[model samples]
Target: MGAQEDAGFSTRQVHVGASTATASPRATPIYLTAGFTFSDLDESAAHFATGSGFGYSRTGNPTVHAVEERIASLEGGDQAILVSSGQAAVTVALLGLAGAGDHLVVSEHIYEGTRGLLLDNLARLGIETTFVDTSDLDAWRDAITPRTKALFAETLSNARNDVLDVAAVSAIGAERGIPLVVDSTFTTPYLLRPLEHGAAVVVHSASKFLAGQGAVLGGVIIDDGRFDAAASGHLFPHLAHSDRLGGPSYAEKYGRRARGQYLRESVAPRFGPSPSPLNAFLIGQGVETLSLRMERQSANALAVARWLEARPEVERVDYVGLPSHPHHALGRRYLTRGSGSVFTVTLRGGLDAARHVVQSVRLITHMTHLGDVRSLILHPQSTSHSGRTVAERELAGVFPGTVRLSIGIEDVDDLVADLDQALDSVASVATGGRRTDAGTRGSEREVVVL
Candidate 1:
């Protein structure tokens, strides 16, 4: 324990944040208690004064801290804070930076849930936002004002596969003394590390790819500790100014650790976004196989995108792995390992065709989530993007025909076969064609398939 070990990712992921089990179990034990006990009055007083240990589960817990350390180690960050959901992670991360009257320059092509959170929920709190095209660095620069606290974006846009040039965008934020907060939900650390490229903070919807099995809900915020906290301390009086009793400011006490501490000690706990210890355990189990699942999923996605691009029923394939995609080159530059597996396919037949394909996919699940062991599909315009205006939907690549696909680790050929039959169903219905046994196919998961 005297020296840090530079272990490879696969090794580190499985071994990091290992708790000392009472009976030597190989897996991390879940410390599911709502609160911890101290041996004596001095011990409790010491804990409160130093903030070095756990007391209440709402503020901290050993189980959750283990998972946070693992994610931070994987993300190459100083520390991480776990929250209840991806939306909670984004909310806490932004609220830690901006408050009433503060501004944020955000990407237009983000998850509709996140968009609504910013434009609607946060607006009620007096925070303002200016959405700009993520790829256009000039617009990113033009949107920054004196009160702008952060440049928020996703590494690979949600639903669509538009790649954000992180290095270029971070440079602009650096010039304006603002941190770049990236939602890496689409491209987890296995596919990309936003901090190494230039982002100051990275966030994820751990419920999706991190859990990898769709069994739990969790989120994380990883801080690289490289943002200029000293310069921005003036803007954040909580970290810059002294307490009422005239103690040193958080910046003076924690320095580079202050931003993450603010989120941990103040924002997240006050907002009550604490994750369950059981969910943290599930996310940790999922992280152990993250690299393996991501590799298989990315390869499967590329194969499916190619297949879709060659089909007459397809209008456009919005996967970055395809050469035809506008961001293919930028995707290559950033996502050299693999372009993420979540993408969209626009059908030539519009809404009806979308409905047919979504309903007919026997293998892929019809759900709203991405990043699972099983492939999933959704019709965006009528589902995730339904609340957006026509212009807003168009900006996010959500046409009546656009369908989002999250490729999984299923056999690529089987996935293709499912899509082929579904697309064929669309063509058949269009030409007044009928096929026998259309409604009788069976699945093992048919507990109630009506």
Candidate 2:
């Protein structure tokens, strides 16, 4: 028998989407072929006509479908679509909801790549975005106009570590009948579920936490099945429009599943952002131990944050796990498991100090990626946020002296030692070596040496 409905998250991650092949394989078997064979002409016609069976890998693969189901189950969503990359998933989700002349109200504290997607790529497409300070609910409300289709934000924002008030934002969208799309990449379903707080869709960079080992790249869009595209004809007129065959509209055809089916049937396929079956298999394998990895990674991150706080070279530690962080209370309310691991550190010594610490880290690999089994670091101003202006960068909490850390499931003591060495390596112009503040290194950072 399959897992029970009330099974734990850890149990579900390991078992919810296991293969049902007659051979009874314990793992999800990767269906690596480009296409599936049809038994007869009628079968092929029926498959295309009704969209019932697997036709090609681009549209559907058993391996990809299995992982999709697993993620949907974990996120408390009705359905999910796995895509080529995180950008592709965000593109598909946004494109499905908006088109030419449409607009989106987004959180200012988002990934830089996405900031470019809205301000650059989507702008060319004639769609616009209004960015608001995520903590200001009034800004979110005032930004919405007649063209606004969705309110988008990260559950726990990238780099800055400010926790989103999902309930507050989603309530604003709810009042306006606009669906809320949340990027839960920073806080995976293991730590938070956006749907539970009234978000209509949850997006993830499966390459991060979902594929914990960093061996594969993938993304997923999970729908709560609550947003009725047909209800708002002014915005989603396409859903209400009839087909060439004069058939019932998508809302009439799929009932509550209209939004999900539209993305799966209309948007995802036409855009061609499908995930490779091999990648899907790898993501599924990584997901099996997601809860375990997240638990350890979160714990390790808190220790590192505490350690960073006491450094003379540090200006501030943005990890919400720490009480000193601005969003600690918000994180406490929402991220009950642990405050997220991916956060930024601002150096008092400025850009020179950032360069020194980043170059000196031996254990923490200097990379652009996050949520790996091994710790990683990045200078956002030079890498991810380099395209933006000084003002834009500062708005998103990207500063010249700041470096983002994606904490991994490593020994807390070892991670602390590595940071201590790296931060201590940052030389002050006055001292000509590690900046030694008299009171800064108090009580060895107060973190438990796990």
Candidate 3:
């Protein structure tokens, strides 16, 4: 409403959150102060009573609000709330709805950190979780109980690239009057829009692709304004009843914005995970080029995944973009832009071989993070998922020899060359000498499909 309506994604990203008033900065400037000054006592009292004006940095800030508004627009949500990190965004979103004695049905293929949050932290708080197969629709239906408050899953899983069926799961939640919360970190809005498929809320770890660079740590929760409070009043009494004074319920007062308002006013402030204004500014800059980075990264990832599949030394390739993948059809249907840039490659030489490739790579950095502009490689078995049991690691497609790669926006030829050199090092160790052949590098070799 502020600028252009029916604008394209690129135009919206650059201009959506910008302030248009005269003398306003073209970019969202960082308001680094801890608090704002009020004109008088009446204004301060009104700000505290309504929770509208920014009285303190913990509750809200101008710079942070700009990022929130921009994300909400790009994601096609009614409102958004930015937090310190992706974990905080997820924590606040769920805690606002579910509490002690409540339950949630979650996908088994999500990030391990989120899994730990559910099992280690939320479990102690009396909230229960049921993990089900990512693509098993009937299993998701059966897992929901009478006390189930929400259905949660990732739009695309980490390392393994298991594409989630958003529409199918949302339908299941809709039948039971439950809200569907999805983490769209891997599949950014450029690749897929979860809200259009009936998801009630979308969350992201903006530290990843949304930032387009691994510099800032931020997260956002986008509420689509469709998780009807009155319709699901029985399950979510918190949104339907007012306990703070004798005012109207959140639903009745805010109507379509009930969930988002609750998250901003109640959960996020109580959790005290306020995002830094500087971080918000950097994240907003990243959004300006999200589509460009995602397109290049997706193409680079597909090329590398195909090139890896052609190598005899490789045991398996778990990229959903490849036709050999089990979820290739789902990826094609949901992720028309690209399957994503992060995926795993299994080696025939086991953990020792993985260590060799991890150490030999010159261009691909061996790091714990993903979605960087520079390509990154990591040994998930020993690093990111090390805390998981052997069976859990296997289920996640992480073996002793498995290596996760997050492809960057670099030229495809250079990326392939770097991988070729690293794989050659592994080949040297495996064969006791370097065996060079163009056909071996280009030929389609049999790979273990999963």
Candidate 4:
């Protein structure tokens, strides 16, 4: 089917990019072959020269293509490319647009892995990045320079639950002729489409909610085709200088699929980070129920956030759905139906209490990953954001007692009760007469969880 045919988000999720309308096995088949055979010599040359159709599993595969197309359609983009992992997607997408001597403007509250990639790895490669508060349009404006090639931010940042103003960022990108790239891993396309809000590119770590069950690790980069790479040719030489290498210019050959093509040909192939067909099939299977899982997960998250808010042991809750959150208004403006399934909560007792609650949980798995069908919890200060210094952690809104929760599809009451028991356990440990700084305070400590 054509891209236009896949209109609605749910419709695209259910029916887009299927190779067979009805498989005998009743699922998207996984083509596990390493390479495809061309019909003849002329065909082989044409395929290689043009880079059209599935040439090899490493370069392109049917199963991967199906997943990529479905993701592109879901995000309302011209095309997409699926990679082996979320980091690969982020790396290739950024490297495709910006390179040595270039700079990128990004949100300060991005995933820690991404932060490391941009700050440590990319800096070593001569690419510099400036982190800005995503909510502040002025910060974004000031951060942009003549060498800025792209603007990047998460729709909803991890752990911190900060909601970015996509329109504001997009407008800034447009003014500077830079493409706006947003990581929609947290919100997912079922909840928010960044392209619709003026974003030029949308990305996702399908390892999370898009895969729904945490069974596969994959990533996707979707190009909206709205930005004119040719116009900003100097800033993005890769798109402008394809002719020098006798390869199709990204804008000329792929058009709206330029970014995807760039990632596929130059970035992904060189990095050798292609997703396995089996993983693609699994991720595709997960996509079929994305809407359903997200609905239940969102509801469960809101309930858990409210439950945590009412408890005296909790100092703060960071779910955007809660009115107490600083970003609640922004969440309402950008996140319509639901805030999201992932959030953070801070305990009154500090780091020791946070560790106690994490160890005390019975049902929620104390793991670092989020967006699973089963609820998961992690201490960001000690885990995800541990690489950052204390000052850096505090600036990113990560407190020593902060505990992040990824609400799953479990019953709401059961989740709440589990949290209640965990909080009670923290209180017990704090009041058991260990009057330490990490355990108790002069006044009743309020634990805030977001």
Taken over the whole model, the C-alpha lDDT of each candidate is 0.86, 0.85, 0.87, 0.83
Residue ranges of candidate 1 with Cα displaced over 4 Å: 1-21, 430-450
Off by over 4 Å in 3: 1-22, 430-450
Cα lDDT tens digits for candidate 4, 311-349: 888777888899988899989988886888999888878
How big is the positional error of residue 25 in model 1, measured in Å on the Cα after superposition?
Answer: 1.9
Model 3 quality (TM-score): 0.90
Candidate 1: residue 226 lDDT (0-100) = 61
Clash counts per candidate, in order, are: 0, 0, 0, 19
Better of 3 and 4 by TM-score: 3
RMSD (Å) per prediction: 9.6, 9.7, 9.6, 8.9
Q: Could you give candidate 3's per-residue lDDT for residues 106-216 as a string of tens digits?
A: 999888889999999999999999999898999999999999999999987766789889999999999979999999998888999999999998999998888877998
Any idea what lDDT model 3 has? 0.87
- Please identify which of the two predictions, 3 or 4, would achieve the higher lDDT against the true structure: 3
Q: What is the lDDT for 358 in model 3?
A: 88
Residue range 210-281, candidate 2, lDDT tens digits:
998888889999998875654565578666667668988787787778788889998999999989999999
lDDT of 3 at 83: 93
The worst-scoring run of ten residues by lDDT in candidate 3 lies at 437-446
lDDT of 1 by residue, 1-450 (tens): 112268777777776765454586689889888898888998899888887688889999988999999999999999999999999999999999999999999999898889999989999999999999988889999999998989999988866789999999998988867889999998899999999988989999999999999999999999887645567776677777886689987787788888888888889999999899999999999999999999999999999999999998887889999999999999998888898889999887766577788888999999989999999998787778878766667778877667889999999999999999899867665522222222211121112111
**Using Cα atoms with residue i matched to residue i, what is each candidate's TM-score against the true structure?**
0.90, 0.89, 0.90, 0.89
